[model samples]
Target: MYKNILAAVDGSSHGDAVVEAVASLAKLTGATVQVIHVRPSQVIGGAIASTVVPVEEREESQRVVDAAVARLRGDGVTADGEVDEGLREELAAILIERSEALGSDLIAVGPGHYSGISGLLHPSVSRGVAKISHVSVLLVRSES
Candidate 1:
């Protein structure tokens, strides 16, 4: 049984499935859920790009966290959320660090969305977390 559950969302279509899976698991285990949305920084014109995410993008990320938290609370599950910024490649490390900081016993995340050649090109955050995490991981596959 997990004491604390870390749920990672990217505001993608798979986000809902991740939240729902976390809710169900938390309800069963009586665990508190901490939802996180990581806003990936992009590289542009051979530059590392700005640290500050666009206002609109930040708002959207907050919305994603808020909605997930609300849905979990509405399900009578204890939950909270946070929005973080990091490079796309560092997403797994960020999630791992956050989860460790919060003492999360389990991490629930969406399935990797990439496929075929594109999948080979882009690293999957979910896969990375699963491979290196010290805690248990639940990959909630969405029907999208």
Candidate 2:
């Protein structure tokens, strides 16, 4: 029944699988896919001194999105793409807002890198989004 899907991706090698899953789901439901990648913030803590993103980081982010789009197209699905700053950039809020702005029926997120203790101590954006989203969210675990 989903007509619009917010596919949240990290652009990791594992995350690519989530894109494929989203594409198949979109095909089945006749939904439009809104692909999003959050780059996290350029700074951490109160100061911007910790910024790690070089000027080329933006290009890298763009490349990630482009590659994802190409992958989807190869699968015969053309999805819209948007790249935002990640963790430091408040990816959680962006994901929530974009899903709403895009009128997405569901938000699909890839499983994160964290596992075991890390996953337990610091829930990822995906976990956070799943807890907070008003709409339904589908998680494609990394292994799957």
- TM per candidate comes to 0.90, 0.81
Over the stretch 7-49, how does candidate 2's per-residue lDDT look in tens digits?
A: 8777675578778888898888778788887765544345645
Question: What are the per-residue Cα lDDT tens digits for candidate 1 across 1-144?
Answer: 897999999778798999988898889989999999987775444355434343238888999999999999999999999998887778899999999999999999998887999688668999999999999999988888
Q: After superposition, how far is residue 67 of candidate 1 from its true place, in Å?
A: 0.3
Clash list (residue pairs), candidate 1: none
Model 2 TM-score, all chains together: 0.81
lDDT of 2: 0.76
Cα miss at 31, model 2 (Å)? 0.8
